[model samples]
Target: MTVVSHREDRVQAARSQSSPARSRSRTGSWRPASGHVFVSGYVVLLALFGLVPALYSLYLAFTDASGKFSGVKNFTRSAKDYRFIPAVQHVAVYLVLWLVTLTIFVVLLALVVHRLTSRRTKAVLRFVYYVPGALAGASSVLLWLFVLDPAVSPVSKLLRWTGNDNFAQVIVPNHLPAVFTIIAFWTGAGGWIVVLYGALNTIPTELMEAARVDGANAVQTALRIQLPMLRKWIAYMLILSLAAGTQLFVEPQLVSQASFGIVGNDYSVNQLAYQYAFSQNDFNGSAAISIDLLIVALICAGFFVARGRLFETD
Candidate 1:
């Protein structure tokens, strides 16, 4: 009996140790459950919004306006359409003009504003600059249309240099794109200037002091010390501006309206897509065009991501 009791006690002690081991194993397993829940929620949201819509758009691009499957017929038709090449070229030119001009102007303006102002003054200036960004799309375009009117414009003398009699005549068909680009920059640069200023503020004050101590002039300090530190922010701004440039509908569309027949109705890729979908009643072709623009935007975004210099590091 004594031997049997001793054996039973040993067995119980072993079971106690095994119970704690099992409990720890269960606890380890439970920790991953929260991780799984987070991952599952993310996947669900992606499918519901991002992936599903993208797949639907892809499917639509291969179909007719009547919802009948047409394979690549719509895409091929769009490619061979008369307006396709011209529209592509126009967008290429617009993108170049908008992106390059806006970047240079915004960066320079932001740098100047940051350098020559007190904090309170800079904030107020930033607010004033960003006010144009608050204008609704239609309002901004309308305002520019009036600003471009030669008879009423305060800058009539400058417009006369372009050999334009009136605003309408001044912005000839060929010059319309550049005119619209300038208008866009005037309203849009302010917001980007603020963005760049924010990035500029993040640079270490010690570095600026050190540069000053080394007898570096203001321009030298800005070019060598400040600008290099802003490379990532500049890259981000460029990528975003490139994306926005591809969606150049408002400027061209509004200008087309304001200029009557002076500017072509379908002067941009987005306008062309709208013409296809709405006027031509060809949803598939429009989808194809939209998908093409999406691809371009994706390529620009990918370039930024691959460079590993877009987002903030610290």
Candidate 2:
């Protein structure tokens, strides 16, 4: 009887050990419906804020300034508006500059930083890079306003080289595109570089080691191996930058405000819309400009979609 009791005790101990493992496995494997309640709330909010506003904008776009239905008149009027095309052109220049500079500088910097620095150093550099981005929007613009001021600027010599003796001269329409590009890069590229650096981390170490064995140098390895692996991330960044460029507002608006219209009023599509809606109280005209931009955004989105496979890995 005692022997049987001892055997039962051993069986109970084995069951206890196995039971916890089984429970853990079950718990680990089990996943509830993801974002169920969160997504439901999100959908409601999207319907209310996103869809409803979008529909109202579309409705307003088709109407005249006084809220009477006037099919396509607002759009046609915008087409003939002198500032319309210039706004588009300004944004185009800004986008081109932003995309080229952002991709080249961010990609190169990220790769070099990752390859040349230790992890701790990389972290510190990333934090430094992200500091300006933390300021963001109006605050960063305020800081740059000081930087562009010839009297107060640290780069006063550089500003004077542009022949810009005052704040107004610094933000001339001709220089706005380049100035905004630099500002955009300073405020935006840090975030992208951080993203690229993280993407670089996901690359398999074995591939890099193989390159090393094959006598590839750091630059060669980065360009030949790392760049290819970052195709998706680059594509993502380009799309995001394109979308953002189309919505150019805060920089130009702030520059115009702070510098007193030396940069002009109809500097960006968004500014043009704001001018109509708030300044002129022409909601229909504003909605029309907004719709035009919406169409442009949709076209851009389509372009990205058409090139979808370009971002995919082999």
TM-score for all predictions?
Answer: 0.79, 0.84
Per-residue lDDT, model 1, residue 48, is 96
Deviating ranges (above 4 Å) for candidate 2: 1-31, 38-44, 65-69, 308-314
Candidate 2 per-residue lDDT, tens place, 22-95, comes to: 65667797444555875898899999997898899999999876778999998998778898899989998888
Q: Which lDDT tens digits does candidate 1 get at residues 164-211?
A: 768778667677668768777877788889988998888889988899
Local accuracy by lDDT, each model: 0.82, 0.85
Quality of model 1 by C-alpha lDDT: 0.82
For model 2 the TM-score comes to 0.84
| Residue 210 displacement (Å), model 1 | 1.7
